[model samples]
Structure formats: C-alpha cells, structure tokens
Target: MAERKPIESWLTDMDGVLIHEGTPIPGADAFIKRLRESGKPFLVLTNNSIYTPRDLQARLSRMGLDVPVDNIWTSALATAKFLDDQRPGGTAYVIGEAGLTTALHDIGYVLTDHEPDYVVLGETRTYSFEAMTKAVRLINGGARFICTNPDETGPSTEGPLPATGAVAALITKATGKKPYFAGKPNPLMMRTGLNAIGAHSETSAMIGDRMDTDVLAGLEAGMQTFLVLTGLTTVEDTEQFPYRPTRTVDSIADLVDLV
Candidate 1:
C-alpha cells in the first residue's frame, strides 16, 4: 500500500450521512459549517431524483442544515449530464418528476413520445402504467435506454418503495433492453460530481452510509471512502462485503474535525 493524498474536497450522501427520516442527524450542522468555513469544495449527493436541488435546499434549511443549491447534486443531474455528453440537444421520452425533467430541459433536450433518441427513466412517486407502456414501446422502437440510478428500493415512512431500479427492471422485462445507470456504483456519478466541483479524485474523499453504492463508487473512482454507521451499514454488516471502506466512523460527528 502507498501513502494516500490528503483529502482536499468532500462528497457525501444526503439521506444517510447528513439526515435521516427527514430530520437532521446530530453533528450534521457542525459538519456542514466546518466544510463551508474551510472553503473546500463539497457536494451533498442523493440518488433520489424526485425533487430539484432548489427544493432540496429549502427542505434542508427547514431542518436547520445550511446547504446551498449549488452544493447539492442529484442522480437527475448526473443522468442529464450523461445524456448531454452522449447526444447533445437530443430528444427523450421521460418518465419522472421535476428534478429529472428540469435537468433534461436545462440541457436543451426535447421531451416527446414519438420516436425519441432515448427513453430516460428516473425516480417518481407515481409510476403510471400508461407512461411506462409508452417508454417500453419507445425502447422497442429502437430508442436507447438510460436510468438515473440502479437503487431497487427507496426508503419511506411506511416501508421501502420500488425505486428507479425496480421500475427499470420492469421496463427491461418488457423491452428486453437494460438501461444504462448513470448514478453511484457506476463511478460515473462520482466523476461527474468531482468534475462539477473542479476536484481531483486522488485528493478527494467520499462519506456514505452504504457499502454497496457509496463506498464502492468512491473506491472505484480513486478516492478515500468513509462509511458512517449512522445510516444503513453496521459494523457486523461491513464484514459481509468482499471490500471495505478506508475507515468507518460512528457518525457524521466524528468527521467534523477532519473538515
């Protein structure tokens, strides 16, 4: 093993690392404050593409967590970036909310159902049978498939709800085409976030709760990865994975001093 570069920039998951169940986790405020005071570029990342960054910023503000809109990144943004790079000003038949649609429109993508260049799938509370049928038909008609993230389920007050991955699976069964996932565990999301902040992966760090997505993405992207126990993965749970994060802390509070 070699000596790693100092962590100069940070990327962290939003739900698990910063907050839980719509509430701000303890020490989350202090962590954000320190990052801002240090003048280091940082981004709060999330796979949820239901709400735009502005909506998320306002929600976080209510929780007393000061996160700027620009400092937040979402799977929606990543998917849009990927599409723009692949086919600039292209047309798509989208099945998602404002977060995903706004991103595509911002990149000059036209949303249509008639022989689009791609059938873009994303996170949405309501999955309409009609819309999905249209997407399947478009994909069958030769449109390339793209998805924001591969998360099979999303958290909710009641329980886990079927997310983009699950819905994408349904569409795949119907169309016989696998959509390209643009978010975490793919490393493209990490790279896009790093590029947005003008940060180098070698000198950056990623803080996330899940070993499957967060830690895996960071490790593959050549950044130091920290697993916080405040969310999904546990100490015992870490042992089950074939790979491990660079370090594991009790919570976000433990990372404040490093910032």
Candidate 2:
C-alpha cells in the first residue's frame, strides 16, 4: 500500500486542552482566535456526550469564549454516528440525557422506550433500574451494546463524578457482556470527529490533560498528541503513561506557538 499522507486538519481535545472546570485555560481563547484568524480549522472534541454543540457553545461563551456550534463535536455524537453506521434502521435504548438522544436522532437512529435493537450507555444523573433492566433485556436478546466513553470518573472542582465508564461497568456487570466504547483511548471517537470534519490525520492533533484518554486516542488515530497539565494528569502520571505525547505544555498559553 502507498504511504498515507499527513493530516492537514486539526482535531483538538476539549476539557483539559482548552478548558478546565468550566474555565478557559490561560490563552486558550487567544490561541483559538489566532487559529481562526489564520484560517486554520480545529474542532473542539469532547468525550462528554451529555451536551449538544449548542450547549457546549453556550457554556463556553459563558466562560467568555466563543465557539461555533459546528466546531464542537461530542463523543456522544460520534457514538451515535457509529451506531447509525452499524444499524441504520435499528432503535436505540439510551441511558443518557437529551444531548445523546439528540445526537442519535440527528443521525437517524430511532429512540424506543420498548425493546430496542441497541443499548447505549452513557453518563446520566437520572439513571433508573428501569433503564438498566431494559438494557439487560436487550443484551440478553442479542442487542448490540455501545457506550459514549470509558472515563471511569470525570474531574470536577469538587472532585470526581461517576463517569460514563462507571455506569457502563455497572451494566457490564449485570449483563456479563463488554460494551463497545466510542470515546478517548478507543480512537474511534476521534476518528469519527476527524471524518465528520474532513480533517486529515497528519495535520490533526489532540491536546488535553489526560494521558490515557486524550493522548491515547490521538496516538491511535495517527495524530500528534499534546499533553497539558491543567487537569487529571499530574507530573507523576506522565512518567507512568504507557504512551507519551508529541509535546507537553504547562497550559494552553504555553502552546500558543503551535497553532
């Protein structure tokens, strides 16, 4: 086979690479502004499937950062896309909120309160036994399983909240079946985002705080990876990472030179 060409588009991580705890990393806005001014395209990709692009835009604007809705893509959106590709006419039993549902609908997947062709697991504040039972029944009936992410917990200013992976694990335990995940570390989420935006792997890159999720996904996607120290990954954790990033910076400001 011919050697693959380099990436010509940029794919960036959201939480730690650009913002943390709803706060913009120092110079993140300016870095994006520069990219915008330079006519460079970069998508703000997040593993959080709880919100739509509009939701993320609103939240970022609240932090005094402005981002177009189309420039943002969530792992939930990618998961929905992946499922749609797998089973176009199938109905999905979702364990997430409106964002995930919106993504599924946008991708032409039917949402069913009854027996579904697929079971989708994600982060939710209103998880119910009813939903869990539905998922279990679906799995037992040979329905496909897909999860939005695998992050065990999400870092918050207060601490960590049970992430999608935690809830996914619960269902996994009940069903004794491993669910397919579509977020960082899996690479498919980043690949979906790249394909959606028509970004090339050679020019694309993932910048984030977590080594396991953000960086690993980039590596798997054959894109450059940059690690920032604003979130979960600490200095010591870097030493333990099985894979290292192409670059490491203290903050987004430190990466102002890259974009």
- Whole-model Cα lDDT of every candidate shown, in order: 0.95, 0.82
Q: Ten-residue segment with the worst summed lDDT in candidate 2?
A: 1-10
Taking every candidate in turn, the Cα RMSD to the unseen true structure, in Å, is: 0.8, 2.5
lDDT of 1 by residue, 1-259 (tens): 9999889999999998899999999999999999999999999999999999999999999999999999999999999999999999999999999999999999999999988999999999999999999999899989999999999999898988999999999999998999899999889999999999999999999999999999999999999999999887899999999999999999999999998
lDDT for 80 (candidate 1): 94
- Residue 220 in model 1: shift from native, Å? 0.7
Collision pairs in model 2: 6-202, 7-202, 7-203
Task: Write down the TM-score of every candidate.
Answer: 0.98, 0.93
TM-score (C-alpha, index-matched) for candidate 1 = 0.98
